[model samples]
Target chain A: MNDKKIKNVFIEGAISSEFIGRSIAKHQTKTSIGAHNIFLGQVRADEVDEKTIYAIEYTAYKDMANAKFHDIREATFKKFDLTCMHIYHSLGTVKVGEICLFVFVSSPRRKQVFKALEYVVEEIKAKVPVYGKEIFEDASHQWKVNS
Target chain B: MNLNIKYFGLLTEVTLCSEETVPFSKATVSELLDLLFEKHPDLKNKDFQVALNNEIVSKDTLITANELALLPPFSGG
Candidate 1:
């Protein structure tokens, strides 16, 4: 496969349904793959004690985030023999129950896809320099970091 | 010499601004943190991860005055 065939870095204020659709279509890949796995992370509204999370204020050190994403893409390529991979992460503010990250990995075999997908998502969550502020309905907030 | 330091997330909130330049001799990132903590004791309570030129660095990594230093936590998606 062409090394440049896959799109792996995306930084946006808000991820749209259209973007996701385009990403999937861009693959246009037909390798008679046994299966494809995808993982979409959506923000959820939650009540923390007296505060109710209404939205998420997403922020990132762009230079660092981009660099980290690129490194991750390279690492993923080294670790997996996959057909293609796509990773999208939101920047700025994202509202509650919205998609923040979309990761899709496809391979000829189902087993590799599943393992690679989980590893990619885990690495992204743990290593990326994106910060999220949980904005409460009452106008109060708290920063969300990896736990 | 002076190093340009960037802040993010909780560190930004505590500092009340994003970036600043601080004078210092050549030192490791941990030493810089010690200096920073001495200047702004409030930061000690928050706990931050340091990065040098966008690459995450351990506390022991040496940092020069010319580099861009960042203190932030892991907050990616």
Candidate 2:
């Protein structure tokens, strides 16, 4: 696929449902694939010692985040021979139980699609420069990232 | 000379500010980090990553003037 095939690249204040739905639809058209696997990451309320995580406030260094996302997209294409891939991540603040990241990958067969989707998601989590602030119910917070 | 640096996630909290400028001579990224750590030793043990002009770089990478330095770890989808 051409570079233009990757659309809706953003590290914005927030990611809307419309944007995610459109991304999924865009992949369906690009690939005549029978199967597609999508991974949506949601913020959960967790008890951290004495504090409980009520929500996550996501913040990105915009210029850096965009550059990282672009690099990941190019790398995914080179690593996996697939129909298409689209990645969207939240920027400002995402509350508990809310969606923060949506990764969509499509291919002709279910096996390839599943594997590719997992790889992309794992890479994004490990390499991308996004940060999450876990806010406690009592008003304290902690930054959340992959260990 | 002065260089603008940006901090993210936990680094931001420790520094108490998202961005700041540090006066220094020509130095590598590692050198700059050493100066920063000298001022804020709390960052010495934290898990963080650095970027020079939007690309990830090792701690030993040299940094030039006017480059935006960012310290943030991966948190994408």
Candidate 3:
């Protein structure tokens, strides 16, 4: 993983399928990579108090969140043998059934990518300073907490 | 010194603003919380952690940065 600079992993809205496709296409030249694992987090229309969630408005402590993402990336690289890793998270309103998070990891072996992908995703959920406000169909909202 | 305080997640709903500045003398993190609790008493009941200069600090930690953020539980995936 390019350990040169802190990469901003945030996108304004949903992580579109086109963007994800382009990312995968760009890695074709990395011939040494034998396996790639991807994890996409989609928003669910959960019912709370009988009100269905329509979307989630995501917000973040930007500076700190970016710093935390950088730390997580560094830690994951140290713990796993990965060739490359990329994480993209959505900010602003993401409707239900849309992709909100995308985690991609590549390695020379299948097992490394599988283990690295899970570790990276778990670290992001637990350590990132991003908040999601679950907006219901009635326009009311509640803060989402990771279980 | 003056501290730029940022509120995120549910804390913003209680504070009614995302960012503000509060003047304070040199003190510990808990002292700053007392000042904030006085202004927005509801914040005392909200679950959050204080980050000073992008690093989470304990209440007993001395204030060393001009920037601070109150972050609630993370829900990012």
Candidate No. with top TM-score = 3
> Which residue pairs collide, candidate 1?
A130-B75
DockQ of 3: 0.91
lDDT by residue (B1-77, candidate 3, tens digit) is: 88999999999989999999999789999999999999999999999999987788899999988988998989996
Which residues of candidate 3, in runs, are more than 4 Å off?
A1-3
Against the true two-chain complex, what DockQ does each candidate achieve? 0.72, 0.76, 0.91
What is the alpha-carbon interface RMSD for each candidate?
1.4, 1.4, 0.7
- Estimate, for each residue in B1-77, the C-alpha lDDT of model 1 and write its tens digit: 88888888888877777888898788898888888888778888986677777777788888853666455666666
lDDT of 1 by residue, A7-104 (tens): 43556666878888887776666656556788888888877997778878787777767677777777887998887777888877778878888888
Q: Write the per-residue lDDT of candidate 3 for residues A73-92, one digit (tens) a residue.
A: 88988999999999999999
Relative to the unseen true structure, what is the C-alpha lDDT of residue B60 in candidate 3, on a scale of 0 to 100?
A: 97
Q: How many clashing residue pairs appear in each of the predictions shown?
A: 1, 0, 0
Candidate 1 residue A143 Cα shift, in angstroms, is 0.8
Better of 1 and 3 by TM-score: 3
TM-score of each: 0.88, 0.85, 0.97
Clash pairs detected, candidate 3: none
Top candidate by DockQ: 3
Cα deviation in Å at residue B77, candidate 2?
3.4
lDDT of each: 0.78, 0.75, 0.93
Better of 2 and 3 by DockQ: 3
